[model samples]
Target: MTAPRLKIFSGNANRPLAEEICKAIGVPLGEATVTKFPDGESFVKINENIRGQDVFIMQSTCTPTNHHLMELLIMIDAARRASANRITAVIPFYGYARQDRKDQPRVPITAKLVANLIVAAGATRILTMDLHSQQIQGFFDIPVDHLFASPVFFEHVEKIGMRDKNLVVVSPDVGGMKMAAAYATLMGSALGMVWKKRTSATTVESVNVVGDVDGKDVLLVDDITETAGTLINAAKVMRAHGALSVRAAVSHALLSPIAYDRLKGGEIDELITTNTIPVDPRGLPITVLSVAGLLGEAILRIHNNESVTGLFKVKGF
Candidate 1:
């Protein structure tokens, strides 16, 4: 026998999620101690030896983003020095991915920079879900597994049952039309777009609506929603254009202060998203589905050296 190969570890960010993933994968979470010092510096120590073992570290850089990211780097570095055979960063949500490109001069390509940091920290591979940009996958020199949360989201939407074939998948802006179009094709519905102009970080103005949305149940699709400006603006336009009901499906909900403030006022009917970030479904008008099971399955297959292409399918959606 080649011997048992997988060892899963988690940093301080989302241990509850890590444990859930471990349960799905049929493995115990590797013991590790992560803490902060008085000066607010990070400290990490692997409680169990991982020599010659394939180590997967689960850490989502959400909330206290920089601190969690640093913990992941430290853990990976520790794994490398501990002689782990291969270290795969199982980042269900990659932070700093929105800065994948510089539309203007003097801005840093932060997504690529984060990739370099992972490589420098001795991570052999990366696995993440629904990045802000697909091209971010190319930023890595090491192999990357880019998974999508669509299958999980589609399952919920399919169960709740859409109203009719007249459903329209609306993209909040031109940049997200590709994802929206895919949803449209999957649902056997039409596609539409809202013309928006961003005024500032947390503010936007809706200019116009493209294509037909009259008397259709609208599904607004986007990769992330931090400030809720884009989503609120788009939903307003979609509703004004005679959309019967407007619901949104977002992959990540970084729902900042402004987002929470505005979203609580009820612009969109139901906001569906994955728990790639910290989620509290209790108070908000949003519903969070666990991607833990999906991510867990992918991690198990990766550990066994099995094909993960199967995770990327839904014949209908």
Candidate 2:
């Protein structure tokens, strides 16, 4: 039997990344009309027929989170109603991911709620990269294709020849030790960590560095950074410990105004992140890598019913 036709579409959010993914996959983006109404309501219309076609809607729930999310839901609903064979919501940056659990009383697990909403909105599956919490996969009943940007970062590591130098991978906090360890192992570098305390929503205090970073170039790895408090504080601690230089590789950089302000302070020598969300470096020492190829490959594999295990492997480039 032949595979169903593949049709890729994009919402208003992160359309540039979606276009890049389409380019990588050698496919044209589907035609759709996504707009807003006078009352500030989302409106969606499919310009072409997609009946019996496998549909993938690419949208990152980034800035103006609710607007992008609603657009995604509406697009999925439109595809389902239009008789698409299957629909996959490709979210490069899954927002509200930080609220995966209820750490305190009277707080809602918004991440789970978002998962439920996606499932309820007629998404047959989901494809996302570097979720804030890995456990968010369990929240959905449908299959979730979780991809990582580590391969992209590893490529950058090779491009800069960091693999040949004395290097250490540092986690910004204890919770991110596993991610740091993976990076360190892949790069053949030592592992370190910074103990941090969250003083407020936008402030983090880095208490101490766990491993020796003296005279070594440091790479701080984290899943996501918004205000950059954790990264800046951790970089400061690493430098104070006699590290020659401090750099960071984060999966997602949801940089706000405060983050840009902090970056100007020279706490870190460079900040490497993915194009999962829209980011502007503002002439700062920030590098944005595109994950479109990685995501495009997974989309092709998933559509072909082939194994996607190789996407996780980090081979020397």
The digit string of per-residue lDDT tens for model 1 on 1-317 reads: 46547899998888888998989878999998899899999999999879989899999988799999999999999999999999999998899998999989999999999999999999999999989999999999998999988888778877888736878899999999999988787777889999899998779999999989998889999999998899999999988889888899999898878888888867799999988877776587798889888889888888889988998887553
TM-score of each: 0.97, 0.98
- Per-residue lDDT for 48 in model 1? 88
lDDT of each candidate versus the true structure:
0.89, 0.93
User: How would you encode candidate 2's per-residue C-alpha lDDT over 163-206 as one tens digit per residue?
Assistant: 75599999999999999998888888999999999999999999
Off by over 4 Å in 1: 315-317
**lDDT of candidate 1 at residue 9, scale 0 to 100:** 92
After TM-score superposition, the amount by which residue 286's alpha carbon in candidate 2 deviates from its true location, in angstroms, is 0.8
Q: How far is candidate 2 from the true structure (C-alpha RMSD, Å)?
A: 1.1
